[model samples]
Every structure is written in C-alpha cells, then in structure tokens.
Target: MAEKIDRQEVQHVANLAKLSFDDQALSKITPQLEEIIGLFTDLQKVDTDGVEPMYSPTTEVNVMREDKGIRSNQREALLKNAPDTQDGLIKVPAIIDESEDGDK
Candidate 1:
C-alpha cells in the first residue's frame, strides 16, 4: 500500500517552512505528494543484495596535482597592481559602521 499525506501534515510542514497555502492549492498538491511517496515506496522493493554502493554515477577519478606554494612569491607583483596599499598590504574603506549601536 502507498503512504498517504494528510492535509494536516501538509499544513504542519507549511507552518514549519513559514508558507501559506490555500485550500485549493493544498488539495491539488496532496495527490502529487502521495504519488512521490508511492514512487519511493516502490523503490524500496528493488533487489540489491550484492550491489556495491557508489558515491557518484560516473567512473571519473581526480587526476589533478596537489597545490603548492606556487604563488607565494608573487605578493610584490600583486601589491604593485593594487589601487591602494598600506605598509605592504592592500587597503580598502571600512564596510561596516562600528559606531552604530556599539556593534564594533
């Protein structure tokens, strides 16, 4: 037998998600939700006694090399291109107002 989703259950979920649905919309969605639950129930009957679980469907492997300190020596060049710089680092305007309501 397929599981059923009641109107009360749908209303409770909508309340948890801060959603508001009319009676008409609720009536229309209940059967669709029931169909989805029925599909999942059908899936539970599949035979997979010897099947191995896989994280992804594809057989691709990670062939990328490990990252190294390849850009550590480019700090001088990067700082030179900056619009504004402090002692040796880039500088920008304060984004937040620290004086507002003692927020810091």
Candidate 2:
C-alpha cells in the first residue's frame, strides 16, 4: 500500500503538470491519488514469466480499400450547388468577431 500524501506533494505534482488546484480540491484529490498508487503497487506483485507484451489492442489485417482514381462531378455543376459564388469560385463570409469591434 502507498503511504498517505500531504498537500505539499500534491501541489508540487500539480505544478509539474502545469495545473492549479485550490485547497478544497487538493484535499479531495490526495486520498484518491493514494488509492491509485496502491493499486499500481498491487499490480507490481503479479507474475508474468512467459507472457508476451502487447503493443496494439488488435491483430490488424488489411482494413482499407485500394486507392483507385475515379471520375468526379464537373466544376460548373458543383458551383451551382454553392450558396454564394464569385469569379467562378465559392465565396464565404469573413470569420471576424464583429462584437469585439463594437458592432452589434
């Protein structure tokens, strides 16, 4: 079993991860962290004499279809489906924050 951790150690770990935890949150998380460490400590005692390590979850076979060239829709027909067009190309509105610019 893992030893009980204090606030200082939890704060240090939070700093290492670039995270911030207030006093109430730290108090709650400390015991949960201790329990997780104890579980890992228990797992360390398991014997695996001849077990092979797994790198992936699945035994993968060819899952993708062969990439082959095919004919596609014509440009003019595609342009006709667009909501707005300019100079034979699709035209979209500017992605600006109008509210930040004092515009309602």
Q: Name the regions of candidate 2 deviating beyond 4 angstroms.
A: 1-4, 49-52, 58-104
Q: What is the lDDT of every predicted structure here?
A: 0.85, 0.85
What are the TM-scores, per candidate, against the unseen true structure? 0.43, 0.44
Model 2 RMSD in angstroms? 10.1
TM match of model 1 to true structure = 0.43
Give one digit per residue, the lDDT tens place, for model 1 in 1-104: 66678988889888999998899999998788877887889867888789998779988887988776575788889999999999999999887766785764
Best model per TM-score:
2
RMSD of each: 9.5, 10.1
lDDT of 2 by residue, 22-90 (tens): 989998998888878778788667797898988788877768877987778688999999999999999
